[model samples]
Target: MSSKVSLLISIILHAGVAFAQGPAFERTPLFILEKNRNPENIMVIYTQLDSECRVQKKRGGSEKVVFDFYWLMKRKDFKQVNPIIKKEIRSRLELLPSNDTHSFSVMMNDLKELDTDIKDFKLIVTANKKKGNCVTESILKLGESDQNKKVKLESIYAESKGFLIPTVISVTVNGIDAETGAKVTRKYMKK
Candidate 1:
């Protein structure tokens, strides 16, 4: 066979292999909200649990990877937070088109329309206060009506230092507040 024929065959076989694999997402998270382990003090999502997802839909046949860039921060590193958040957002927005990843971003805060991307898609968060031993529970769903609601994937936490232990972070969402800016706010007991 000619060299050209052999090269074409090689390319076809490589393409087939690539197509077989799918997009990759890590169980590792850039950051996490953890419950205080003290038995006396239970964990309650003080103000509200904001759950927002920034989705980058798959394109073509490329199996993209979840974007998980790790970094460290000191308390003083961020003097004014809004500016920082905005700058970070702007940077990421520019890079989104260049990324070969199928990633989602979780954002929060009282910026009013800070997180309405999923408003039409919608997610319901229930912040049930802890009672006796029942413990506080939270649920996340997509869509407004129960018929349209879809359960999210079971989330696993990622830890380092001690180990890359997978941890699950749960937050209760009372509702999605378009006006208040605080979506899924919970009442926590302090005593």
Candidate 2:
């Protein structure tokens, strides 16, 4: 039909336009988790992958995302956390700019994956079991009717043994192929 042909042409044109505009690197905050007791400490995750060329210009960089972890602490003070530990492990990765303990930026790349080298990494919750209102990664599509709905983070389990540990978060990302329109997803876990 003529309508179908017009739609196909439109898609081709849009694809061409997108191609003409160089790679648009962007970061989209997809999920997060907060410490059980300390509200000031939270792990924010971004699902967008910054390309190799974009990251390694100055030096070597981390490429792929690997594992989700939590830095367990008994006290609210993060000054005790080591700065070198963030990127010391050859095959590990964690948030960087060591000065900021409150909100850490994920420092990673694509070719090589990253893992958070936390000694006592644990899960705060999941879809079924939850210690408190926590976070994990899930690829989801927003339905037309659900677009405006807001999901609330509720804390049901309030009891902690005086230890303020962050909620367990997982590593996962989703994308769509520019050429094929097929959906793509990647997740990394420890052996």
For all predicted structures, in order, the TM-scores are 0.21, 0.24
Q: What C-alpha lDDT do the candidate models reach, one value each? A: 0.26, 0.29
CA displacement after TM-score superposition, residue 75 of candidate 2 (Å): 19
Query: What clash count goes with each model?
Result: 3, 6
The CA lDDT at 94 in model 2 is 41
In candidate 1, how many Å is residue 53 off? 14
Writing each residue's lDDT as its tens digit, candidate 1 over 114-181 gives 22223432212222212311111112333443333333322212111222332223332233333333
Q: Which stretches of candidate 2 lie over 4 Å from their true place?
A: 1-23, 50-63, 66-137, 140-191
CA RMSD, predictions in order: 21.5, 18.4
Clashing pairs in 2: 62-108, 62-109, 63-109, 63-110, 64-109, 64-110
TM-score of 2: 0.24
Q: Which residue runs of candidate 1 sit more than 4 Å off their true CA positions?
A: 1-62, 69-71, 75-182, 186-191
What's the CA error at residue 139 for candidate 1, in Å? 13
lDDT of 2: 0.29
| Whole-model alpha-carbon lDDT for candidate 1 | 0.26
Tens digits of lDDT, candidate 2, 1-191: 36643443333223321211112233322233333456445332232323321221112454433223223232122132344533342223343332221122333322122242322221111111124211222322312333322222111111123323322233443344333545444343322
